[model samples]
Target: MQACGLDFGTSNTAAALPDGTVLPIAPDTAEPRLFRSVLFFPEDERTTYAGAPAITRYLEDNAGRFIQSVKSFLHSRSFRATQVHGRTWTIEELVAVLLRRVREAAGAQTGAPPEAVILGRPAVFSPEPEADALAEQRLRKAAELAGFTHIQFLIEPIAAALAYEAQLSREELVLVADFGAGTTDLTLMRLGPSRRGRPDRKADVVGSTGVRIGGDRFDAELMRHKLLPRFGAGTTYRVRGLSDKRLPVPQHVMAKLLSWHEMSFIREKSTQELLQLMLESSDKPETAEALYDLVMENLGYRLFRTIEATKVQLSREEEATLDFEEARISLHERITRAEFESFCQPLLTELEQCTQGLLERCAGAGEIDAVFLTGGSSQIPAVRKLYVDRFGEARVRTADAFTSVAEGLGRACVSLVSPDLINS
Candidate 1:
């Protein structure tokens, strides 16, 4: 009768038990215990599979079997994927596989099956009004299919704040900046003492803002601009591809890019599609597999890691160097922190614009109580500095920067079902 909380994100999916420990579900499932979010199918036609083994099989036999970031697909009316035999599958089916994996993981984690579950939903789904309802219905159905008798949708930002509020005092306005794999959401909340005392908590939303960007998009940017250009896919080889000739390079690059999938770069359609297009072209015998391999290594995969590393190194160090020794591309000159800031400036600006819009909405209403910072991207000094600059260090705080929401949802699920076990 344990409750469950799932942070079904675009890049990574995580689940937590009532005891408040969170673990990642392995996508291509390696060891039974290690957690990953990716799910792979043996073939496009085969029912999509889940776990580390599935991922490995897909990488070797059918690289296209992956159905990544289901959370990003929420709200879409249809999800179309090709089976190994070229059969088409619906979005619901894809979701079903993902949900099923969640259930399986949960069942294995705890002896008792989950009676009720809490799932996190994005702030903005489809731009069309009708699409929003479709997204919600799809999610509900997927949850039911996954075996939860009861399911609840919680806003990610709010959930993150609630998780942090557990140990925090309920006296002030707080800001919850949730930078996940796909989107960045800023929620302003005020926590009040629980009326019921079963360790209950109340939260009021002061202002909420969302940006259609996050850590994943940044990886794509790096790959597209910095890494790919070197090998000349869109540039030198307009009809580029992956070939045996390009093996070492593409393999290395793809490995690096795949390594950073946690960044959620695949959500950006233009970039994702472009990368997909490149992959598709490589499928053709006409394109030199070597070229494809080279591009894949030089630009397709390796680029994002370099960019990610640059971003991270720039946070504390004044400069960082990225060298693709295999591909023979190197940014030997010091990449100054200033340069890194400039590179990320646009993303920061977009986030700022979103924040400004939220502020305008709350201008006359009330001030944001506290600024809660969480997520891998939130750890960036550039991002951190921005928040601190706006709301001083005292008002700006980062609690559980990585796993707050998932853990909070776990606790919330337990509380919703069995209030008496509050402290447990």
Candidate 2:
């Protein structure tokens, strides 16, 4: 196989060849073209698994370390490493494990392992310049670790723009919106048959902007507003001292519960002891104990899976039930579109600010010929309304009738790709 375009997304990953055709990397999953971004390490089992088998293995045995949303932590300064079965794995190393899996799958598709890749990335991984640069550097290191001799990057929204432009018959100035699990990127660029194969697209690119908020943040919001109360997010606890003074549970405990990826880390002895103390001094002992049980049993992912299902259902229905049952905890909540939208109002506002910042670099909303939407979160009616309200319903549309970032990256890679830029 030749150098391919790889979209290693937060929630899912996809790769495409130079011919603008996406590779069905995850043939085992329901969506063959899209591989879920998950990794599982079974207890006492040195064997690791990625993609569909990883999820399956983790779900079946429920005894291993299940990791997701790995891409979301790339830019963090505090997140240095994670201990996986006693060996500490850095962020880049963990990412390399997933990238290596993607490379092998691409190799399987064409019988030639690709060592060159053009990776798709958000327009801004971090607003801070140092962090953003570090994020890109870490990604390149991960690609190198995955055995890619030549690796490059394209802004995700621009890649989507290329895919949109490939199908356009006439020239037009358009705004491409590429939403992923961890970020939403927007690009205003010139596109169409007239400029399809340009080697240098920087001049044609008018502006780009992105936010670190996307579907994952929406999931966190759903968990925070709808589910955290059941786990004692807002409840107060009594002091163990003789004084009758009551204290609220520290917000950090709830924050850990909100983050499924870090939930396992909180099971240290110190945390467990703290939970015991909180359980002993709580006004609502049941909720506090439930919180303790959630951590001890490592049920964060299972609970968040229900949260994800609920969000998906609300995208199509007016209401969805967020339901989950563990040995000791039962969550059953019905939420309407209006209520969920209200919960996500703050996130939607941030998105507006993000897009408004991008539009400031252009003439106006009317100057945009089309608005291309990508990613699963774009299907949310409330999110779609944001663009439609600004740029009329007729002007807004999906990119290539699917998430087109990987396809667009593939098109971008068709321009004289090298197996090894350093050697060749």
Q: In model 2, which regions exceed 4 Å deviation?
A: 364-366, 400-402, 416-424
Instruction: Kindly report the root-mean-square deviation of model 1 from the true structure over all alpha carbons.
Output: 7.4
Write down the TM-score of every candidate.
0.74, 0.95
Q: What's the CA RMSD of model 2 in angstroms?
A: 2.3
Q: Per-residue lDDT tens digits of candidate 1, residues 117-213?
A: 7887766665576886787788888788777777887777877877776776455666788887778987777764552123334335676667777
True-structure lDDT of candidate 1: 0.62
Root-mean-square deviation (CA) per prediction:
7.4, 2.3
In candidate 1, position 297 carries an lDDT of 38
What is each predicted model's overall lDDT from 0 to 1? Answer: 0.62, 0.85
Winning candidate number (TM-score): 2
The worst-scoring run of ten residues by lDDT in candidate 2 lies at 415-424
Model 1 residue 152 lDDT score:
80
How many clashes in candidate 2? Answer: 0
* C-alpha positional error of residue 305 in candidate 1 after TM-score superposition, expressed in Å: 5.3
lDDT of 2 by residue, 1-424 (tens): 3688899999888898877889989886788898888899999689988888988888788787888988888999898798888889898988898999988898899786687888988999999999998889999999999998888899998989988888899988898887778899999998889788877788889999999888888999998888888888778876666578877888888898776877887898987877887788877888887888889888888887888889989999999888788867888899999999999999999898888878886755347888888888898888889999999999997954344999998888875364333111
